[model samples]
Target chain A: MNNYERYMGMVKGEQVDYVPRIPILMHYAAKHIGASYADFAGDYNTLVKANIALAEDFGVSQLDIMSDPWRETADYGAEIEYLETTCPQCLKHPLEDSKDLSLLTRPEVGKTTRLTAAIKAIEAYKAYGYKEYSITGWVEGPAAEASDIRGVSNFMIDLIDDEEFACELMDLCVDVAIEFAKAQIAAGADTIGVGDAIASQMSADMYERLVFPREKRLVDGIHEAGGLVRLHICGNTNHILPVAASLGVDIIDCDWMVDVVKVRELFPKNTVIAGNLDPVEGIMESTPEKIHQNFIDLYHKVGNPYFVNAGCEVPMDTPKENLQALCKPIQYNSSI
Target chain B: MMDLKDLTEAIKTGNRTQATSLTQEALDADLTPQSILDAMVVGMDEIGDKFKRNEVFVPEMLIAARAMNESMAILEPSLVKSGYKPLATAVIGTVQGDLHDIGKNLVSMMWKGSALNVIDLGTNVTPDKFVAAIKEHDAKLVGLSALLTTTMPSMKATVEAIKSEELSDVKILIGGAPVTQSFADQIGADGYSPDAASAVDSAHQLLGIR
Candidate 1:
């Protein structure tokens, strides 16, 4: 079976020949393709070249691509500040001085400048995917995209201080994301990766009230569009794991703190958990032996229908041998 | 209603009012300034542990640190008037190419609350900057943070430069998303903290403070 088939089969609860490795590799991919982070996020051809290079170099089973977190905010007319080495950042909040959700315009999914470029990239990548390799198109999740548009500090205070406005902003962001996800699916993306690293920081109560429904809607929308959904929340999402699982997302991409065993306990029998390894300490700092043992430990905790990956994107400076040990399968007794 | 457990719990949950009130109550009950400081440190340390275990996160940590700071503002002069000495002086910063200062800032605040004299170098600091800070502060403990993987090497290089300096006696601590204990040893750093809170314990242990 090709990598795509194996991943799909595992997600479908079918037996797979081996575990799949879907580590998030953005900066690393850009590094592999020898492209600047600027070009990688701004230009579609640069992103495509880097991603294709990443797939070949890392032997990753899936192609998941995201154009920095600024895409949605930029479309909403936020000022984006691009650095030489790092990902572009949103400079001004679109909803900063004015908390008026009514003034917010929902940009057409296919017409927004760079977002259209992202959709085009998805189309091009999906057109050439191997039968077994899954093609992933990405969109910022409601909380993350909301933070981009309405500033993180403002959103936090608004959650308690201006509840109605926060919900309205969330709804607007979700509508745009759903339409974007649908466009990506129509463009041939077989899977949609939702980048919602910000939502992981919310309290369980706030999450259930403000963020959960919008995430559920986005996941449901992707499923309705005939595409699989993978949710990437890159922080300690332990408190919201149960609610996150209940959102019915096909796959949950965890970061360092969400233990795989805990995820297995919380999620339904068939739900696939991608990762929870400390990207920096475990893979970037540790030796080959340490990395190998860490993987073995993870495998022991994560049983069948689990993919091997770090909690977040692999660091650009991650030792090559350490990364190899992470993706390379190791033998472990399943009875643990 | 206001007691030590309540105070610690307040600090843990980042409840500033309860923490401040309980701290005052503890002081009113003829508790020593050292006792209040110990309790505050213990509470902040517990918050740190929970953070390291991923049971808590930045917002909670920030509030708890803020609460502890508020209490510390009330307790510091008392500790000094009674002739209490801080454990040590620590200089901390985020290495170059990394703009993430939240974790670094939190750690610095926690250190300050723990009664350590912390000289914060802020974010996007360079090796020469660290060396200069070390020399200027005469700091015994130097803490470095790097949120980006690409900047982690700068952390290692900073450590290397410090070790090569005349005062190799300075204890070095490293953190951020990419730093690990193994990497700490690889770079010859004196300690590695998993999170901002753990940095407190590691700093204390490295300095033999507690």
Candidate 2:
């Protein structure tokens, strides 16, 4: 089977010819076309070109539509400073000095700056991509969006000193994420990747009380929009794996600290799982032979429903050969 | 209304009122500065244990930490004036290009309450800033933190930079949600802890303070 066919088969819970390769290539894309991160995140054409080039060069089964963490907050009027080598970050949160929820306006997905461009790019990709391949879009989860709006430290405090406000903020973020997910679906995305790296920091109680409901709401909304949901929490979610699995995510992207064997146990049989490789140790700093074995081991741990990816974004300077090693086994081994 | 044993239990269960009231009562009863500190450490230690076991979480830990810090404010000066010394001096900070400091700050607070002299370098610390702080404070150990995979390199780079400067003897400790012992060894960090409580254990072992 072709790469796209294999990926679709696995997602559909059918037997696949091989494990799907879906690297989280962001800066890798910019480097592919020799464009800077600043240009890649800020310009729609550059992003589309970079993502397309990466999918072709790497033979990845799915093409992702993700930028830096600042996209949603930027639409709400936060000041963002872009960089060449690093993902763009919020210079200052829009609500840094205030808790006036009334001042926060719900951003219209397709009309927001840069967001519209993302939708346009996804729509553009569907026109060009072959039928077998799937396009994945992206949105910031509520906890991450809270960090973008109120700053990380402040939000941690808000969780305690102001529970009501925290819930309000999360409610607003969920609404915005639902709207954003819908736009990406309308723009031709077959799946939506929810980036909620910050949510993993909270205690299970706080997470259940404050974060999980909103995430479930957002995930439900994306499903309603006719797109599959991939949840990327981006940390050692070992303690919360059961909670994450219970959310009914199509794929739970594990960070390196979470053991794949443990994740496989937490979720039901046939739940799709991806990642847990140390990006620095296994890819950026290790040899190709070592990296390939790591992938082989990961596949054995999680079996057929797994997608090949790092715990998070592929490092900017990861040796080309090291990353290329990730797909070597899948390309050669029929049942990987 | 506040009993010492109950305070320790309260902190473990994230009971702030009992923790605070007992802390004040401990002071009012003429309990030795050292004794109150001992009780606070006991409470924090249990909280840390629960954290490792996944019984308590960040928000509960935060409340327990805040209660400990507030009590420490009243107790720290007394301990100092009584010629008490922190078990060791340690410095902590989050690496460059990463602004997530909730984990780092929590670790630092736990260390401070556990009787270590902690110098916080705040977020987005460059190697130069770290090196300068190490030299200025004469800190024996360094703690590096990062929440982003993209910023993990900065932790590795800081370790290399510090070693390259011939300050290799300075024991470096690393932690955060994304960091693991394998990553710590690969980066040449002297120690790694998954949570704030373990950081105290790491600090003690690295310094031979225990």
Candidate 3:
């Protein structure tokens, strides 16, 4: 079966040929295609090409359109600098100095700066994808986009100093995310990965109070658009796993520090749990054999309804052999 | 109830307005800056320990740090006039090829709260710049941060570049999400810390400071 079918099959609890490898590959993909990270992030054509090339070479199942958090932030009139080798840098957060909500309006998906570029990526993937891969579109989750425009430190303080203003800002952000997620779905995305990485930094109570409802809104919005949801939060999320699971997204990614055994028990069997491997140690600095064995052991422990992923992105300079070892498929283990 | 303990509690709870006012009140009431600073440090110390135990998360630490900073704005001038010096001068930054700075910034704030006299070089800092800052400040410690695993090599490169300089008495402290103690040893970092509060302890341990 094709990778897309294999991915959905596992989520649907159908026995697939193997667990699909849906590791997030952006910087690594750019380097793989000999394109600068600027080329990969700024231009959708380049992003699509790099993802395709990465899948061809490394056998990652998902064709991901996530380059950076600045896609929507840039469209909101933030001055962003695209480095040759790394993601774009927002020179100034639009609301960093003034907590001005008036400075940002909803960006039209096709007319705005970088959001347009992402839509073009979804369209481009649809054009050439041939239903062979699971095309994953992305949006910064409510808190993440809020922090992106307000600066992380400022936003964190806002959460404490003014919960009301924080909710207002996140309300606007979640609206934007919902709109963006729908557009990507309309443009032919099978799944939308909502990256609420900033939420992981807050206390579980703060997250449940401020972020979970908005994140739930975004997830429901995506599902309403006939798309799947992958909630991607970076850093240790052992505190918020139950709240995260309650969102009922199609998938939840556990970083290396998250409790994998708890996650396996927390997520329903059909909700594909991806990751819990240290990207730096398990993949980057590891031998191919060790990497393979670790994944195999992880797969067995986490059981079925899993996607093979590192805790986060595959480091750009990971040994090709290590990636190959990770991608090397194991036969479907139905009984696990 | 106008005690320094209130200042400590204000800082710990991240009540910036209260922290600043209490700090000023302490100053007005003839509480020496050092005693005030010590009380404030206890609040940070408690928060840091809670952070390490996962009883508190980043927001608590952040607000606590912000509160400490707000109070420091009032307290710093007095400390200087009283002939105060920091524990040591330290240089810190997110390594080159990585621009994510929450971890680095938190560590910087923690270091500053501990009276380290930190010279923050900001994000995407190159190894040569680190070396230059170390030399310029005659810093006793260097803390390198990178959020992405991709930039861990940059950490290694910075460590190597600094080691090659043979700065006789400088220690390198490395951290971020993906960094491990083994990675620290492999990269030749003098020390490693997983969170911001412990970073102060690590810095003190590395430098043999109280």
Residue A277 alpha-carbon offset, candidate 1, angstroms: 5.1
Clashing pairs in 1: A4-A132, A4-A133, A5-A132, A255-A311, A280-B178
In candidate 1, stretches whose alpha carbon ends up further than 4 angstroms from where it belongs are A16-18, A93-108, A130-132, A150-166, A202-206, A276-301, A319-336, B1-57, B64-89, B147-152, B177-180, B204-210
Q: Which ten residues in a row have the lowest lDDT in candidate 1 chain B?
A: B1-10
Off by over 4 Å in 2: A1-3, A14-17, A96-98, A130-132, A153-164, A203-210, A261-270, A329-336, B1-32, B74-87
Best by lDDT: 3
Go through the candidates in order and give each one's C-alpha lDDT: 0.79, 0.82, 0.88
Error of 3 at A297 (Å): 1.2
Residue pairs of candidate 2 with colliding backbone atoms: none
Select the stronger candidate by TM-score from 1 and 2.
Answer: 2
Q: Number of the top candidate by DockQ?
A: 3
* Per-residue C-alpha lDDT of model 1 across residues B1-210, encoded as one tens digit per residue: 335777778888878888888888887787888878877878888988887776666667777777888988887777889998766778899887676667788889888877788999977788898889889978889989986555778888899888878666689989876567777888889999987888888888888877
Per-residue lDDT of B59-156 in model 3, one digit per residue for the tens? 78888888998899899999999999888999999999888888898889888878899999999999999999999999999999998877888999
**Candidate topping TM-score:** 3
Ten contiguous residues with the weakest lDDT in model 3 chain B: B1-10
Candidate 1 per-residue lDDT, tens place, A21-97, comes to 88877777777778898988888888888877766766777776675788878888888777656778666778878
Give the per-residue lDDT digits (tens) of candidate 2, residues A224-280.
999889999887777666677777788889888788888888887667788868887
